[model samples]
Target: MFDVLQVGQQHGTSTDRSRIGAEPVLLSLSPTIVGSRGGAMVTMRSGQAAQAALREEHWQEMERFGDFLTDEDLAALPQTIRDGLIGVRRPGGMRYPAFQIVNWGDGTKEVPPAWLQLVELLAPAGWNDEFLILWTSAPNAYLEGASPAQTIQSFPTEVTAELRYAAERAIPTRPGGPGSWQ
Candidate 1:
């Protein structure tokens, strides 16, 4: 068993330009760790694995999302809920990936159900938000050219299959899975 903890600073940093702080997100992985890419593999203890993973990637905050969303728009959403959006506490502020908030082009915005299921599945495992965002944003062979988030909005069946694959890969109990520290 592993314990994961994440606490954000009360304020944001000058670089990130928002109210997010350095989140020492604690992730507990199994004896064997999976690299950020789904198929790559590594062997390390949980703590070392977590630190190494954090060092491997950088996170961008909500402010960087450009026209997709504004501070006012994010404020309108419920901050405490994981729901469909994934928020990471960064030195600059609470940032979300641009893909999480889809612009319908008709002025209606909605979170895809598949996206929400993936977030809910991985969050409790202490999966870093960076990893989560990367997985969703990265290209997958199963979804053709679209990332998971995009597929979630455009193809319902593809999204469900993708989410199932992600969950299987992220948890260690399932063999050949993408193993997390926990």
Candidate 2:
């Protein structure tokens, strides 16, 4: 069984703490478990600390994608190419992830055709940009613990197959007619 961390009341004055309410909440992520006579002791960050850590981790992960293209930067590209790129909403505005772009020594950049194909496969799901980004970057069980973004370059076929399966799963199907009770 997975170890669980029980977080007590937060110590900070930030309003984010109130969101956790008066009760201590349990979390399973990154828990530190220790054996004791009673049972076990689990240590974890407070709500505020966990939130801060999550924000920092998100910022660092976004940094790994290289430079994010702003509206002005994207406007420099042709409309067709711009439309094919994946852009996520941020605090300021829409920022395009440049992971698909291959930069040449001459300063020109090109988006891989395979990346566009992957985007096309996921388009029918109508997932938001943030979800798309997370889905690609996060470790997927369907991909055997490898993130789609990590293996897409070397294992395009496998990634494509997984994406197709995910798309099919996302489609809602009715088991029977709406009027039917059983």
Candidate 2 lDDT, 1-182, residue by residue in tens: 33444466434343557677765544344444333334765444455457656755774577666547888888888776676678777667887766556555688666656567777767766777776776676676767787666656554333367755654454344455332234
Error of 1 at 78 (Å): 7.5
Worst-scoring 10-residue span by lDDT in model 1? 4-13
lDDT (0-100) at residue 15 of candidate 1? Answer: 47
- Per-candidate TM vs. native? 0.48, 0.48
lDDT scores in order: 0.57, 0.61
Which of the numbered candidates is closest to the native, going by highest lDDT? 2
* Per-residue alpha-carbon lDDT of candidate 1 for residues 1-182, written as tens digits (9 for 90 to 100): 22333454233323454536765433433343445435755456677877765544433322344513444557787654235566655554566665665546787566655666667776656667767776676566666666676676665322476656755665666445466454
Worst 10 residues of 2 by lDDT: 173-182
Question: At residue 20, what lDDT does model 1 achieve?
Answer: 67
The lDDT, on a scale of 0 to 1, for candidate 1 is: 0.57
Overlapping backbone residue pairs in candidate 2 total 0
